[model samples]
Target: MDLISSRLLFRPMEERDRRFMRRFLSDGELTRWLPVDYPCPMEQVHLHVDRRLEHWDKHGFGTFVLEEREGEGPVGYCGLEHVTETPFIDLRYGLVQSAQGRGLAFEAAMRVVTYGFHGLQLPRIFGAAMPDNKASVAVLTKVGMRPDKRFDCYGSNLFTASVDRVAFDLKAQPVTHTGIYGAHG
Candidate 1:
């Protein structure tokens, strides 16, 4: 299934996306705050994409390749996945350098979070960002997730934020049905 926001398209990750995933994950600037080191190994990149594919197969939903609706190459990815070793589901997103500071992440994330709560009937969805990644934190906050906790993971101290169906419904704008359709929709 694919999710559509006003400016971006969210298509399910596929095996063939390895090439773009490799290049995107290799960008040190874009990935600096993420758990993985910049210029991630090709093997790790393959593993990363494979993990997304595996996640979708195992759990029925995972990250989506983010692209502009106008058909430019993929800019990044956004969606929810189970937090390893924990009983939590986390929302994540990343975008190309050229695509940052343009509200694309927020747009894609807002759509995904809405889907998580209303579409998936998830009780809560969480997000974690490095304490210094104000942009990422801001995006999560804007999506109605409140600060939940702080923890160390993958060599970085992360601040976790969360939103349950009730809080999300209170804070979120009335969802205007748009491009949402298909399996995950």
Candidate 2:
């Protein structure tokens, strides 16, 4: 299913998206804040893409490619996934350098988190950001997630945040059905 926000389209990651994923994963500036190593190699990129595809197959929900509503190439991705070695589901998002600082991440996240709660009926969703990545933390908070804890993963210390279905129902600005459609309908 594809999720629609006001300015972006969220389509499920496909095998064909590997090319863009390679490019997205290689951006050192962007990946620096993420848990992955920068200057990602092609093999790792392929593995990452494969895992995302497998995740969807196993869980029925995974990452979504973020594109402009008017048909620009992919700018980034956002979705829910199992946090490795943990029982919690993680809310992850990232954008190309050219697309940063435009509120696109927050928009994509709000929609995805909404879908996690309403569409998938997930009990809760979690997000993790580097302690210094204020922008990412802000996006998560703005989407109604509160600080949950701090943890180490992939050698990086991360600040985790989460929102339960009850908290989301009480705090989130309800995403209107009119603005979201495609596939899942």
Candidate 3:
């Protein structure tokens, strides 16, 4: 899906975006909170991009690369991903060092949450951040998600939270809620 949110543009990830992905993943500082290994290699970044494409084909929704409306290239990626074997759409977002300030991550994440609720008719969307990652935790909180639990994955701790369409509608503009898929909480 293609979308413009506030100051950011959201579009699907193409193979050519591997370089952008690699750039973002290469920064240990930016990729620290991710529940993955450090120093993500370029080859691994390509594989991740491939998985993102596959996710879009199978689920009709997946990661979208984000860029500033006035800017030229990818600043980060924000969207939902299926965590492991779970049937849950785990909200996720990440930005390069260049896009760290100006609240772009929050803007991009809010857009993704809105798409999941009103665009994709998702009943609920979940997200998690390492409690130590203050930046990520702040983004999740600012997007109207609240901590629900703590769990271990990949031998790391993650604080998980969720927000549903009903809550999203009540918090965001009411007109944005569309129950095309029957309401569920």
Best candidate (score: TM-score):
1
User: TM-score of each candidate?
Assistant: 0.90, 0.89, 0.87
lDDT of 3 by residue, 18-101 (tens): 888888888888888887675688778777778898998988889999888899988889988787677678887888888887
Candidate 1 local lDDT, residue 60: 89
What is candidate 2's lDDT per residue for 33-138, written digit by digit as tens?
A: 8865766888899999998999999999999999988767999999999866777888989999888998889888878887888889899888888879999989
lDDT of 3 at 132: 89
TM-score of 1: 0.90
**Stretches > 4 Å off in candidate 3:** 150-156, 174-185
User: Candidate 2 at residue 43, lDDT?
Assistant: 88
lDDT of 1 by residue, 45-103 (tens): 98788889999999989999999888688899999998777778889899988889998
lDDT scores of the candidates, listed in order: 0.83, 0.83, 0.77
Clashing pairs in 2: none
| lDDT, model 3 | 0.77
